[model samples]
Target: MTLLLLLAAAALQPAVEPQPSLAAKELRRIPAEEARQGATAGHGSVYAIGNHEIGRYDAKTGQRVARWDGDPAQFPHLNSCELDGRDLVCAASNYPNVPMSSQILWFDATTLKLRRTHSLGHGHGSLTWVTRHAGAWYACYANYDGKGGEPGRDHRETTVVRLDDRLNETALWTFPDSVLERFSPRSASGGAWGDDGLLYVTGHDRPEMYVMRVPAKGSVLEHVTTIALPTDGQAIGWEQGQNRVLWSIERKRTEMVASRVPPVK
Candidate 1:
């Protein structure tokens, strides 16, 4: 697929190692922030999707691979998107990725052809990335309390929806009120699962990082913690100078920042 990657200012904020998985030893990243909604990675490619459009970049060289996307079928909105195994997953939402009426589209990575479409019933939120954890797939959608425009992403509630055989929200895990109260009623944005099996979620606008263990049961999810995030969208990326792994932070006007996860040793 043809890609158009545009590079900009590069900066690496001091990094701090978190856990066994989010440790700076595991990831590599470059500084290219877009009000970055979501990130998708595969082979030698990485996708960073936002409200403007989608971009494909060389994960190794940090070069623009391509840009492909359009308007939402219903509203003029496209939330976040991710890559499943060998396919490209995208979500278009007027209300965070919800709506029994709206759908999430899966396209072929090589051909970019529309393969399958799944619908999330009403009450769903702005869909971000489709995460695969514990041999099962989950769709990450954020419910926002903001009004509109890019700034709206900052005020949202993240919804972790469990898909049934029919791609329905059989069981869902949402942020507890205590965790939500830590930050403003912000929107939950990009999230990713590490090789360590821990699920790291970011508040669209909240200044804290929410990490949750793929709980054995829904009720156990209350253990989710809120760590300070330098910025929004603290998902995953390579720390520029240190060349490590980290939960990348969302940038305001530019792209997201690939802050170091820890001090370079």
Candidate 2:
């Protein structure tokens, strides 16, 4: 009787596919080995890339498009990515697999084809992603001292790179120690920008997020505020409209939360 019941339950649910949501939701969920973090737009379209492959999706329309291997050589580990004009810029790194090394890869926005890959050098580090501001593209990364970002993985600083419209790095800005201290307790995690002209980053240490003003006419950024978050907060970003809306993603539970970041009175 128990066996029969188990069989009945199994029959009710569809057989698990390589990526269930990609097929069910009409949005390609890149292979886990290839993608870890993703970004979406207002029209139900999302860009999923990381690890070694890249995919595009339209959740509502159920269109899942993928490029077999975005960058196979850099595969198995891309921490984060973002859309730049008509390109997908990713921060490729060896997290637990390989320590202290990562690179940036550029792909054509339409076909999801590889355009160029830049070696960013070695350091126990992971980049948050890239975004456009003042007609320039930028990406941020956390640098650690030890392996797999172990507890001993002392962070020296966070970096921001200026890229061309084609997604190539042209200039770099390394936040100084004073600016890094505001994030006193380092938690090398996700980050995003706010319409308030602030950059928001998350922490693994506790249920909290921090906001800092993008330095004006300077290289070092300044911390402005810290917001409380749920325990499982894994990634964060801000979407600007009437006001800057802040979003937090709890990956494990597949949940997300949004809040507003308003102007200073």
**How high is the lDDT of residue 214 in model 1?**
53
For 1-265, candidate 1 gives per-residue lDDT tens digits of 1232222222344435333223222234445544356555566666666564666677678777676555545434555555666777676566533232345777776555567776664444556556655656677665545543234334334567767646755667766665565435555555656554566666556555566665676643453545554555533432222333443535554444444343211
The clash count for each model shown is 35, 6
lDDT at residue 130 of model 2 (Cα atoms)? 58
Instruction: For model 1, state the Cα shift of residue 9 in Å.
Output: 46
Could you estimate the TM-score for every candidate? Answer: 0.67, 0.62
Model 1 Cα shift for residue 234 (angstroms)? 6.4
Clashing pairs in 2: 26-62, 51-77, 51-78, 52-75, 100-123, 100-124
- The lDDT per prediction is 0.54, 0.54
Off by over 4 Å in 2: 1-35, 59-73, 97-99, 123-125, 149-153, 161-186, 204-207, 216-219, 229-248, 254-265
| Model 1 TM-score, all chains together | 0.67
* Candidate 1 Cα outliers beyond 4 Å, as residue runs: 1-35, 72-75, 96-101, 110-114, 146-158, 214-220, 227-230, 234-249, 259-265
